[model samples]
Target: MPAHFRQERTKIVVTADNEVNIQTLTNWKVSVPFLVMLSDSSNITMPITIEDTLNQCFTQETTEQIIHLSPVCANLLRRVTASDPPFKLISVTPSPVGESGEARCIIQGKGIVSLEAVNQLGEHFLLATTYLSVGEYGIHFSTENLANGVYGIILRAADGREQRSVIVIER
Candidate 1:
């Protein structure tokens, strides 16, 4: 017998009629909207087990794809470093690229701060919180396996100041 996991309005169940195995097939059809809505409505988060089925129902659809927006003061000096000097994002390159590629950028300005990459929702996709040495700095990122989308590089200095740079990626 197939069992279904349900909570509230969401219904998740495993059926014996589902495609079991096929070495000749190349693709399988799935309903994204239904899955998302069902998953959302249910309390089941992930790592679901399909009892009696060898293959688990693992899906990457819930993965987040974000667009990073550049902050207004990305190029402005916001805080001074330990040397009491101002800091800012001088320049960044390869503004956009596929997620399976690399993007390089250089930041020039006085004083040193922290740096990172953030999504459109202002969430840190990649955090480079380490303190930088004074003077110009260059940051190289390798998003070889990251989700295809847009992101922003955020930088902060010793004086608790911050900056942002834009980056876009596609599959």
Candidate 2:
């Protein structure tokens, strides 16, 4: 028989937000599950914190269940919450800039009403600046090829909502 043939698996119950409430297990070993609490409903970029479920029991099955929690979600959430205003820089994809490969700074805000992409010179590069809808906004900049420098992202809404972040490009 295999070395692990005699062990049993534990069953765990979790909430929609990835909160684990250990239900039962043959053994008592436990590994903590990751926690993900939503701070901003509009932008799912920020995270509250990184935590593990209490290991009340000490069984192989319980340990394995807690280890099953994905680390990516925990890490990302940690970065977002590191700052006063929780948000994240989604990505900087290539965009059209007078035939040059200009990267567009994509930002994920938390329940934002509107957003804008500006350069160091305080110029608006993306068109249709306002986020008419209450979801992800794609801002395309039609400026000269961005040089190796830094850019700014300003998120704002008529309801006095605002968020700011910076993006830097090497190429």
Candidate 3:
């Protein structure tokens, strides 16, 4: 079981996936540790379980990887939309991008304020959030697969008026 549904964490999870079908192989391994406290989590603060087997690996032959456990609700739908607008971020861009290149952002004050890109800045390590309506305005990111350094550019505006910046992903 290797499920992953990330909202804030470096290391992609593909949102959540679990697949196991081995009649008999040999090498098999799976791990989940980067702040994993999943003691079969029956507490639920960020508790995750998709057949609860959070960590184990003693391989011989069968191999398939990626397990972090998420997607019971997937962080209640990681918010790229779900409506939280009051927009007004204005900008979050460039700053020496490279690892994949192409990064841009903007928000005007009114509504529809959502933009996400993170690899570390305050540690919510998420990367990329989409809201496409292209033609003008601004909002574009490609970053290939992202992996360079300093990547945090956030703006999820509403009443709190959130805004953060730091993109320096040089290759």
Candidate 4:
């Protein structure tokens, strides 16, 4: 199992245009779900922190059931809907960039612009930019130029909607 699938939901703090403090994956299609706060929404005010529930989707009926079970979970689902977690990945066959079984990752979303991987101590890995696509970003993630164990992912949106999420980069 991957931390993105379990572990404490990545914490996203929405400050007053102040700055998104860090912390934090991809692909053989690893899903990095994030509930981002859009700047265009009239209903959104600043300084609101959104925690937990990344890359989660639920229909209205399902949402109702979740609410019945746990109001906290239901509220998270609603927040995730407002900013919609990135894409579940359209598709990737035999490595998006690296050779077959080369441990590749692709973080695809409309607003995601930059991607970074960090280790347990918040140390960043020196990533090679060769595999990066023009629009659809791809990373040839590995344990060499990067760390071995699981790390945190820091993804920033072009619209200034920043999010923090967990990812398991296993060799």
**CA lDDT of each prediction against the hidden true structure:** 0.39, 0.36, 0.41, 0.33
For candidate 4, lDDT tens digit of each residue in 22-105?
222111111224343332111232222233364243222343221111223333422132233343322222322232112223
lDDT (Cα, tens digit) per residue for candidate 3, span 65-153: 44333333222322121122223445555557664333333333334445556676445534545443321255555665656666666
Candidate 1 has its poorest 10 consecutive residues by lDDT at 33-42
What TM-score should be assigned to candidate 1? Answer: 0.36
lDDT of 1 by residue, 31-67 (tens): 3212221111112222222332322233222233211
- In the range 3-53, model 2's lDDT, one tens digit per residue, is 111112333222222322222321222233433343333322322333445
Ranked candidates (TM-score, high to low): 1, 2, 4, 3
TM per candidate comes to 0.36, 0.32, 0.20, 0.28
Report the number of the highest-TM-score candidate. 1
Model 1, residue 150: what's the lDDT?
66
lDDT of 2 at 130: 42
Clashing pairs in 4: 24-152, 24-153, 27-105, 33-55
For residue 29, give model 4's deviation from the true position in Å. Answer: 34
Give the clash total for candidate 3. 11
Of the candidates numbered 1 and 3, which has the greater TM-score value?
1
Tell me how far the alpha carbon of residue 41 in candidate 1 is from the true structure, in angstroms, after superposition: 58
